[model samples]
Target chain A: MNKRKSKNVFINGAISSEFIGQSIAKHQSKTTIGAHNIFLGQVRADEIDGKKVSAIEYTAHEDMASIKFHEIREETFSKFDLTCMHIYHSLGSVKAGEICLFVFVSSPRRKEVFSALEYVVEEIKAKIPVFGKEIFEDESHQWKVNS
Target chain B: MILHIKYFGLLAEVTGCNEETLEFSKNSVSDVLSILFEKYPDLKEKDFQVAQNNEIVSKEMVISEGEIALLPPFSGG
Candidate 1:
C-alpha cells in the first residue's frame, strides 16, 4: 500500500478516554482489520528530593517531530502488514495519571498488530523530538529522558 | 550567512529563549556552536544533538542558511 499522508499528531492537552473510544468506533467499518492493539502513556507522579510530581509539560520541535513521525509511519507500513495506524501525543500540561501519548495499530491478524504496535511505540520514544518537563508539586521542574 | 537557531527542552531553559537568529561567517555546525557557546556559556554543559534543515547532523557537517535546532534527549512516549 502507498504510504499515508502526514498528519499532525499533536493534541493540546491530555488525551481523553472518550476520544480514544470514538477512534476505535470509527474503525469498526473497516472489516478487513481482524485485530487492533493500543498503547497509552500516562504521566507518573514520581517523587524527587521529597517533592511529588504534579504534572508534565510537553514541548516539541514540531517541524522535525512531524517529519520524524511521518518517517516512522512510512517505515512501519513497509515493514508490517498493517491496515491502519494512528499516533497522538499531548502538548502543554498533563497531570499525573492522565494520558499523554496514544498509539493505535490495526492489522488483519493478531500477530502483526502486536509487533507493529511495539515498533511504533519504540520509534516514537527514540526518534521524535518531544520533550517533557516533570513538574513537581512545589513548582520545581526537571527534564525527563527516555530510558 | 544568517542561520535560524532553535533550542528545545532543557537546552531552551538554559538559553532563556526558544529560538533566535545569528550571523555566522563560517560554514560548519561546529562554527555555529562555538559562537553560541560564547554567548551562552552554560550551553556547553548541556547535552544535545544538532539538527540542520530538520535532520540531525554532526558538528563536522557544513551548513548554509537554514534552520538549526539544538535538541536535548527525547522523552516522548
Candidate 2:
C-alpha cells in the first residue's frame, strides 16, 4: 500500500525565486540525500505573426489535475530510487521569463536524480491537462498547444 | 439523464461557457458529442478529447449520469 499523501501542486501565479530557494533550504535536515536535481520551466516570449507574447494565463480541471499529479508522483517513486520529489505549477497569469513550473527530485546518489528528474518532467508535460492562453502584447490571445 | 458538460481551454471560448447541463437520452460518448456539435458547430473544428467523469474515454465508451469535459491539447510544462 502507498502511504504517501496527496498534495496540492497548483500555485496562484508565477513561482518566485525566493520560494524555490526556501524549498531547497528545507532539505537540510535530510542528510541521507546526496544529490538534488531541479527543473524550472520558464515562460518564453515568442513572437507570433506580428504580435509578441506578453504572458500566459493557465487553467486546469482541478480535480483531474490533482489526481494526475498524485499518480505521477506515485509512479515516479516506484520507478526511481529517490528520497523525495516536489512539483509546482502556476494557475493564473505568468509573465514571460517567469517561472511557471518547478520539479525537484532528490536521491542518495547522482544517477537516480538525473534519470528521475527527466522522467518526472516528461510525464508532467505529456500527462497533465493544464491549458495555457498566450496573451499578446496588444491584448490578443491564442490557445497554446504542446509540441 | 441529466449530464453535466464542461468545456476547457479553447473549447470554452468556442462554446462561450465553461459548463452547462443537457438532458441526454443516449448512452455513448459519441451521442453526447453529436448534441454538442449541433449546438456549437465550431467545436467540430477544434481538436480535443473526451473525458468521462475525469478520465479520458473513447467515443464508443458508454456514459451515464456524470460530468463530462472536452479538453484540448495540453500545453502544460
Candidate 3:
C-alpha cells in the first residue's frame, strides 16, 4: 500500500545474472537505503532413484498469485522499516543450478533488511500458490513439495 | 449457478485442463468437489487447497460467486 508499484513478479525463464545486476544497480540512487539483503533460489539436480532432475517447470494461478504477492509486500513494508522491496520468480523451464526465485529487500539499516528478507521468503513458501514439476533427465516428472 | 474453476500445478494435470466453467447447484465446497471428483477421478487422490475470491476456503464454506482456484502444495521460494 505504500506506493509499491504492485507489479507482476513472474519472469518467463531463468533469472539472468545480468537482470539481477541491473536491479541492484537501480537502487544506487536511493541514498536513504544503507543496506540490502537478497535471497536467490536455485534449482538443484537431485538424483532420485537413479534419475537426475534436469529442470523444474513452474506454474501458478496468476491472478491469485499476484494478489498474494501484493499482500506480502504490504505486510513486509508495514512490519519492517524497509525502503524498497522487489521479488521475481521464474515461470518456465529452469534447468538445475539456474535461478528460479529472487527476493531483495532494502532498508536504512542492516537489521531490518535481514529479518525482513527471511520473513518474506518464508511467507512466499507457505502462502504463494506456485507449483513446480521436477523433470528428470529421462523425461519423467514429479511434483515438487516444499519442506 | 455457474462457477469458474481454475487449476494450478499437479491439480491441472489431474483435472486434465487448467480452467473450466461448470454448471452446478452446490451449496458448499465439498459438494463442488464431489462433482469434480466424478469428472476427474484422479483429483480425489491429489492434495490441494481451494481458494475462492483469492482467499483459501474450507470445505464447509458456502460456494460463492467469483473465480475459484485448486492449488496444489505451494513449491514457491
Candidate 4:
C-alpha cells in the first residue's frame, strides 16, 4: 500500500482547507493527469417547516466508521481508473454554511475525474456511519443519519 | 448473564448514561433489545442499530457471558 492511500483516511472534528488542497497537489504530482476535480460539501442553514437550522454537530461510531471508510476507499479504487483520491469529513460541530466535507479526485483525463468524484461522494453518503445533528438557530436540534 | 451495553447519540439521551450493564438470560441481540424496551418503554419507538464489541452486528448475533453491546442509531456520512 502506498503512503498516499493509507494516510488518506482521517476522522477529525475539523480540517484545514489548505491541507486538503496540498494533499490533492501531492497526489496529482505523480500522475501526468490532464484534469482534476474537487468537491467541497458545506453545511446549509435552512428552515425545517418553521425551525431554522443554524449549524450541524457531526458525530460517528468511530470504530465502525473507520472500517466502513476503509472499505469504501478500496471499492472506489476498483471502480475508477483515477490516479488517486482523498476524502475528509468533519466531526463534532460545524456551523451552518461551513464546509463539512472535501472529496478530491484526479485522473488522466477530465471524464474519469468527474465520474470518480461523483462516485466517491455518493458512496460516502450511502455507506459511511457518520451522523449529523442539525442545530436550529434557536438552539433546537435533530439527528440526521444518511439512509 | 450480565452484559454491558453502550449508548451513543440520541440513545445516550434516552438512557441518560453512556453505558449500563443489565442482567439477561442467554439471549440474542433481539432478546436483549426487548429487555431494554421493557425497562425503558420510551425506546420502543426509536430506531436502533446494534453493535457487538465495536463492530456493527445483526440482531441474530448471540450474547454470551461477557460481551459489550451498543445501541446506536445509524449516524454515518
Backbone Cα, N, C clashes tallied per candidate: 0, 0, 0, 6
Model 4: per-residue Cα lDDT at residue A124: 78
Best to worst by TM-score, what's the order? Answer: 2, 1, 3, 4
Q: Which pairs clash inside model 4?
A: A129-B75, A129-B76, A130-B75, A130-B76, A130-B77, A131-B75
Q: Which docking class does model 1 fall in?
A: high
Q: State chain A's TM-score for model 1.
A: 0.98
Tens digit of per-residue lDDT, candidate 1, span B1-43: 9999999999988999999988999989999999999999999
Q: Model 4 over residues B1-77: C-alpha lDDT tens digits?
A: 88877777777777788778789985888888888888878788888777776666788888775555454455444
lDDT of 3 at B26: 72
lDDT of 3 by residue, B1-77 (tens): 78999998888878788899988887599999999999999899989999998899999999867777888899986
- For model 2, residues B1-77, the per-residue Cα lDDT tens digits are 89999999999999999999989889899998998899999999999999988799999999988899999999997
Candidate 1: share of reference interface contacts reproduced: 0.90
lDDT of 1 by residue, A1-97 (tens): 6648998899999999999999999998999999999999999998888999999999999999999999999999999999999999999999999
Alpha carbon deviation, residue B49, candidate 3 (Å): 0.3
Off by over 4 Å in 2: none
**TM match of model 2 to true structure:** 0.99
DockQ, cand. 2:
0.90
- TM-score per prediction, in order, is 0.98, 0.99, 0.97, 0.84
**Predicted model 1 interface RMSD:** 0.5
What does candidate 4's lDDT look like per residue over A1-147, in tens digits?
A: 533344445446555677776876686457577778888888777678799888778876666667767777777788878877777888888877767888888778888888888888888786666668888888888887555
